[model samples]
Each structure stands twice: as structure tokens, then as C-alpha cells.
Target chain A: MNKSSAPRQSLGELLPKLVVAPTFVVAVIFIYGFMLMNAWLSFSSSRMLPKYDWAGFIQYEKLFANDRWWVAAENLFIFGVLFIVICLLLGLFMAIFLDQKIRAEGAIRTIYLYPMALSFIVTGTAWKWILNPELGIQRLVREMGFESFTFDWLVNTDMAIYTVVIAGVWQSSGFVMALCLAGLRGVDDNIIKAAKVDGASMPLIYRKIIIPGLRPVFFSAFIILTHIAIKSFDLIIALTGGGPGFATDVPATFMYTFSFTRGQIGLGSAASMMMLMAVIAIIVPYLYSELREKNNEH
Target chain B: MNIKRVLIYSILGFAALIYLLPLVVMVITSLKDLDEIRSGTLLSMPQALNFDSWDKAWGAACTGVSCEGLKGYFWNSVLIVVPAVIISTVIGALNGYVLTKWKFRGSTLFFGMLLIGTMIPFQVVLLPMARMLGFLGLAGTTSGLIMVHIIYGLAFTTLFFRNYYISIPSELVNAARIDGAGFWMIFHRIILPLSIPIIVVSVIWQFTQIWNDFLFGVVYSSGDSQPITVALNNLVNTSTGVKEYNVDMAAAIIAALPTLFVYIVAGKYFVKGLTAGAVKG
Candidate 1:
């Protein structure tokens, strides 16, 4: 609406470029620049504060030799695998059952999907209460006459990680159900009908004819879930505080603990770099094929 | 056939309870006193529908060293989220317009770089970003946190808009160009009028994310500038005091209310935003 500023042809040509330049520069510096800084910090002898001097492979060596890092890595495997598999299986079953000619589908779907909307902090807090041995399910069980019932995973070092898995599954499995439902809606009706005509049962039709067609949905779900699993800091902090003696420390919490809380910036940087590598290892291929597919379709 | 139908409904009902229990427990537990919480079961109803814990969690309970509860931190989140969401959405719309309608040479590569920004684990960037904030003398300030959110949030906002604007045919822009429309003029007249849906998606996504964020809030900001998520975590995990589960649950629910409200209201857009960016964390 300003009078003379708009009609200039040169200004029009330059304005779009100018508009985007700041964000572009920011992306380059903050995203790329910060990553380079971490990589450099990892290789340097950074302790309390960041030092730019090179001390090659020392942090990585320390990281590898650390028992806590190994525990975190092993925890990531157990957490990641169980989280993904349980979510997929539970999500698939829920989606299939809901896809039937069911009543109140919208209401039920909202109940299942509402957890996705809550912060992981909230999820963790609620679960922390639910899993607390003295105040939670174990006490409730004992009150109900099961005198020796012991569901004390919250304080149990060996089983504390699975409490995390339970909470993780509770928070995330619903999203998987949403994804599978979308995929199910996209399934060709004629194919399912033909399979039915051939006397294939419903489960057989889903397993043999339908579920395999859902690989793309499964792929997208897998990538998102894995990324969430890797970047999971808040939930672990809220639920476990990486505690019961750091038994539930994943890479995210591990990085936070060393770099900020403990002031071992070098070790923390290494942990962060490993996390970045895990994301890259998963994402590079995902992005490559994703972008390629988009291009092919366009 | 009847058995199969019964089985499906029962399974669904059971699954719904699993998802609903924690939320119900959170609300009920927040309404109960320490005595009631101790005496009754986890799922027990409160004695008298007490407002004691809610008042304490909102106004009096300790978060870090402050006796002021989640009310201050709640405002901090609102202040930060409002500016960050608006600024990121506007910039994202402009960037999307250029990347799609005004495709200059090498813009694709530029967009690719921005896309990569979305996937970089935040842990990798924490040290440098913190130092960068200190260097700029913005550490421990709300403005610095806003800047950080806008920067990281740009990638997802851009992705949402670009994917949306691409579905807009370019011939409309070409026609407007022939009628002597300039860049901002065309954007004001054409693209903006058509961008309401994607703008909803971007705003909802951004609002929910920034409101719920703890990583940047915990690391970069300190003292009074901490967001509600950080404050809630500190309040719940504080080692000194006797654990007040009622106050803790109340604070958690308070921290969760905004996003849950948005999800209940414009949940179609929320779900659209989630499915729209599969790459989003």
C-alpha cells in the first residue's frame, strides 16, 4: 500500500531474494556453523569451557572406553527396538480393528491420539507417578490382597529401562495407529474385495495382501519414531532423571549431563556427535529417496 | 460374527482406557491432598474437589529458587511463542513464495541446505549456540531464546509452506505479473489470501513446539527466564523438599493445557501439520 516503493521493476526483482537472504544466512551459520563447532569441540580438549585447540581422537577414545556410554548405547538399542516394534504391532492391530465398520470411530481415535499432543515431559511425569512402587501399581496390587506383588521397575536398576519403554510406547504408539489408519484408508478396496472372494480370511487378507502394501507408511513411521527415540531428552529427564544410577541414560541425556551439568564439554560434544551420526545414518538415505521420489512424481 | 464384533469393540474400549488413564489420574491426583493421595488408591477420587494444590502449583510452589509457581513461566512461554510463531510464519511464507514462484538459480540447493537444518540433532548445536548467545550478549534473555527458536523453526515452517505453495498453480502469479503486480503486492494480494490453511498448520505446529520445548529453555536461559517446561521439570525433580505429587501433577497439566487445548480445537490442522512434515521431530 505504500505509493512509490512498489512499482519499481528492479525492486521487485530484488525484494524476493532480499526477503530470503537473512534466513538463508541464519541456516548456514547456526545449523551448519554450530555443527562444525561441535565437531571441532569433540576433537579438542574442551573441559569446562570450549577450547579450539586440536586433540584428535581423544574424546572418542574416552567415549568408547566409558562403561556408561556403553550402557547408554545398549539402552538405546533395547529402547529403540522395543519402542519401534511394539508401536508398530500395537498400532497395526488398533488401526485394523478401528478400520472395521465401527461406531464412535472419531471419539475413540481422539482418545488414542490425544497422547501425541501432550509434551513428553507431561507423559513422563504421569508415568513416573503410575510406576512409583510405593505409591503406584504395586501398592494398589498389595491393597487388593496380592501381598507379594512386586512391580518395582521404577527403582529396580535392571528393569528400570523397560519402564521407559512402557512410557515411550504409551506416548507414541497412537501416532503409529494414525499413520496405519491413513495407509489403510489408502488401500485399494478392490484388492481386499478380491481377496475376500477367494475365501481368504480378514487376517490373511491383511497379512498377505494389505500389510505388505503399507511399506511406505511403515518407512515414514519408522524414520519419525527413530528420530524421536534418538532425540528423547525430556521424557527420560522427567521420568527417570537418567537415574536409578544412570541405568536409563540414552545418548541425549548422556550428552546433556556431560556437557552442561558435569562440565566435560569434550565428552559431551563426542556424545552429541555420535547422536548426530546416528540421525545422519538414518536420515541421509531417508532424505535421498524421499526427495528423489518427490522429484519423480513432479 | 457377533463374537467377532464384540471382540473388536472390547479391544478398542480397553485400548482407550490405557490411553485415558494417565490423563484422568493426573487430573484427579491434582485435586487431592497429600493425605488423600497417601490413603486412597492411585485412581481414587478426591475428597472435596480441592483447589488447594492448583492454587499452590500456579502461584506458590517452588520452581528452582523461586517460590512463584508456573504462572510466571507460563507467561514466559506465551511471550516467547507468540513472537517466534508470527515471525517464523511470515518469513516462511516469503521464503516459500520465492523458492516456488521466483526460482532463481541455485535456490534449490539453498532449499536443500535449509531442509538439512530440520534434521540436525539439537544436541550438536547446543554448545556453539550457547556461546554464540553469550558472545552477542543475549544469553539469559527472552529475546535470545526467540531468536534461537525462529532460526531452528524456519526449516519446518518453510517446508510446510513450500509443500503447500507448490500445490498452487503458477499461472495465477504469471497473470498477476502481467497486470503490473510487484513482489510484495502479489504476495499480499494472491499468495496470502490462499495461505490460510498452511498458515494454520505452521502456527499450530510452532506454537505447540515452542510452548513445550525444554532443551533450549534449560540450557540457554536461566533464573526467571526459564519456560514452564523447564520450571515444571525442576519443580517435579527438586531434591530438597518433600515431593508434593499434587503440585507436580497440577504443574504438568498446566504445562500441557495449551497444546491440548489447541489439539482439541483445531486438531484437524494439528494432524495435518504432523502428517505434512514426516521429517519433523
Candidate 2:
């Protein structure tokens, strides 16, 4: 818009070459360029090889018809919703509780927030062991003289999705807590003082005043977690391998199996494109609103 | 009213316990004998504490012809991860700095592409990535894996630094430019020092991601070049004659220890790093 300054600003035209060129080149060629290649592969009759031969919609058809693909789609939805909701609730509660002027707050905060540092490779396997029917909670309860104990969700096809949800919530809720807690910190202390003057109950104050104030942070947390849910592979692969007969399968793993293990590159690419579309559909609107909100704040 | 405070503390404590329970189980199972692990409760004390499984996991578990444990791939992971972290984070920081400070035309679109790269699941891009790597003669090597990590790590690292950079006053860069400092000079001296918090965050995030990555390792590495996660996967995932529960648990713990250490040590920074963008921003 400032056309008069355009030539003057070009005085530094060569500056970006030092830093920007390397980043731009890598990002474009390796990332976007490869992505285009992937999209092309999806449309071709490739199978464990680079078959540039044309084969439109065939891969897509197979991708849609595959039971595993359908299961993965369903699993993504179930896990995504559950993971987002529970993480939000737990994160909010932790943030609010930590906001209270409590003793040992720093230490407790660290304990609540440590999980985000560890990768799912570790946490997922730990969860797998902990949720194992024979080695984990079920057996632990049985030894306590509760012989009727049976919490084998990891092995149960119908309930394996919940197992993924549990581990997911555990891993991510801490990060969400940190976000909400920071938002809580940013909340003007005056508002709380005003609430106290009005004799608002703690729960009422949190529910009405704090929660609403924290909505943007909450939304950001939700969006990030939703993306994580959609792209969840490490946890599923590590803990269950989409196992107990593909009960906990997700799109990410489906993509992997088709592309690598099963040697169905075209189908895998098609499945991935579908997953990409799903992610874009969900993310674009949420991100637009979030950015708009930021603009409004500024 | 006094009791309610106790109740709140208790609830928080209980929640923390739930979160920590699995980690406790993992450590315990690693120390237990197979018989004890088989019959023992997950939360139960080991009948006899043993280091055998740890030794076995580190040095004795077999993948094919070799019975050497995760130690073989340990160096491979390190070699791959260190460079991958440094390269990606450095590039990411530069990307962040240029995008936010420069704000050239189409900068937002460029950023949009970077973010899109992050959101697209890695597996979705695996087939083409494999082909590309194969064509480049980098497939199934440490270089290939490092390339993958850098590409994947770009989005998040850029995100971390960009959000942090935006928080800095623009006047700093302007003033530096007035002093005739070039991009690299300003970035290296001024911007990087100021970015300690976020750099720590970026390093930790990238380290854990690269360290724990299994899919990339499996697809991009072979033979002695496989990272620990791939070895760990092969060890635990492929059940043959009889599953060695103790060794498996020990191997899992071994595979996870580095990241676990990062969490326990930099736990505060980790949360701070992640929440820095959403909460602090």
C-alpha cells in the first residue's frame, strides 16, 4: 500500500539471500514439492515403486473400499472428539486449581506439566504395559483380592479406542494446562477482585468469569490436540499397532501400512490425500477464526 | 471452607497420580523377573529386583543374526538426531526471524505453506518421500532419516521462534539495522541470545521427536543405520516363539529413558515452551 517507499525498501533486497534462501529452497523443494509428488503418486498405479503410469480414481476407490481405512476414519473421529473434550476439561481444571494461591504451587505445576516433554514412543509403550490386562491395572486389582477384576480395554476390540483416548489425554492435557494456566495468569487480577467483592462463589467465578476469558487459549489447545489426534501414529503403533484386530487403527497408521508394509503405494497416497482433506477441512476454518481473533486483540 | 482447600489439593494430587501411574508401572515391570511380571500385579513390588532385563535389553536382544541389544542403534540415533535438531532448529529460527521481521510480500503465504507441512501427517507423504529419497540415493540411511526429521521439524520450530520473535519489539531490529549489522550478525548476536527460552524449547521438542520417531527410522533406515525406535519396534512388536515380557519392558524403558530424562529435567521448560505460543502470546 505504501508504494512511495517501495524502491527505498529494496535497498536491502539482497539481505534475505543469506538466511531466507536456504529455508525457502528446502521448504519448497523438500516439503511442498515432495507433497505434490505424493499427490501425483496417489493418482498413479504405483505399488512399492515409482510407476508414473496413469490410474485415476482407482487408488481412491480402493482406499474408500478398504475396511481398515473406514475403521481408521471412524477411530480418528472417536479419538479426536474424546481426546479434545477430556483434555480441555482436565486442562481447565488444572489451570484453575493452580491459579489458586496454593502452597507448593511451583512443584505441583511441574508434576502436572512434565508429560508433554516425553515422546509418545516412551509414553505409548508405558501405557501399553500399564493397560495390559495381565501385567497392568486389571491384574493389580485382582491381587488386591478383587478376583473379578477385568479392565482389558487394550485387548478388547470394542474398547481399544478408549485406551488410545486415555493415553492421549494423559500425554497432552499437561501442555493444555500450561496454556490455560498462562491464560489464567494473563487474566486481569482486577476482575477476580471485583468477583470477590460481589461474593461470587469460586465455582461460579471460574465457570462464568475465568472460563470465558480463557476461550481463545482453550480453542488453540483444542485445535492443536485435534491435529495431534488426526495424525496420531506413534501411540497407536507403539501401544497397539492398530491392533486387537485393527480396532484402534487410525488414518496415519493406515497410510503407513498401505505404503510400506502392504506395498500399496497408490492406495496409501490416496488415503493420505483424503486424510489431508479432512485435516484441511477442520483446520482452515478454526485457524482463520483464531487468526481473526488475534487481529481483533491487536 | 478450610476442608475445601484440602479437598482441592487432594483432587490435584490424585490427578497427578493418575498421570504418573503408567510411568511407575513401566519402571517396575522393567525390574521384575519374567515369572514375577507374568503373575505379579502391575503395581506390585518386584519379588526380587533384577538388573538382568536391563542388561538383556541393552546388550542381548536379537533382531536377526545379531543378539546385541539397543546399543547398536543408540549411536545411530544420536548421529541422526543431533544434526537433525541443529539443522532444523537453525533453519527454523531463520525462517521465523525473516518471516516476522522482514514481512516481505507473500510472507504470510509462505508461512501458510510451512504450517500446512506440519499439519499434513507424515505417513500421508511417506510414499512420495520414499521415492524422492530413493531417487536421491539417500534412502535407508542416516542422511535420509535426518532429512525427513528436518523437513518435518521445520513447521513446529518455525512456529516456536516466530511466535517468540513477534513478541519482541520491532525497534530492536530497526536499531540493529541502523548500526549497519547484517542479517546473520544481528541474528547470531542479538536475536539468538534473546531466544534462549524458545531455543531451549525448540531443542527439547525436536530432540524428543527425532529421538522417538519410529516410522521415519523404519522407512528411511536399514541394517546398522536404524535408529533405536526401529530396533525397539522390531524387538517388542514382532512376537515370535515366546514374548519376553521382562526384556520387552526393559527395552521399552531403555528406548524411552532419554526423552524421560528430558521431561524430568526440563519439565518446566517443556511446558513453558509449548504453552509459550498459546498462553504467553
Best by DockQ: 1
Q: Model 1 over residues A231-283: C-alpha lDDT tens digits?
A: 99999999999989999999999999999989999999999999999999999
Give model 2's DockQ, 2 decimals.
Answer: 0.60
User: Over the stretch A1-298, how does candidate 2's per-residue lDDT look in tens digits?
Assistant: 5644667545466566446677677778877787788888888999877687788888998887888888999999999999999999898888888777878887887777766666676677778877888767888788889999899999999999999999999988887888888889898889888998999987898888988998788778877887788888888888898989989899888888888888888888888888788888887898788678789998
* TM-score: model 1 vs. ground truth: 0.97
Q: After superposition, how far is residue A268 of candidate 2 from its true place, in Å?
A: 0.6
CA deviation > 4 Å runs, candidate 2: A1-12, B276-281
- For each candidate, what is the lDDT? 0.91, 0.82
What's the TM-score of chain A alone for every prediction? Answer: 0.94, 0.92
Clashing pairs in 2: none
Accuracy of chain B in candidate 2 (TM-score) = 0.91
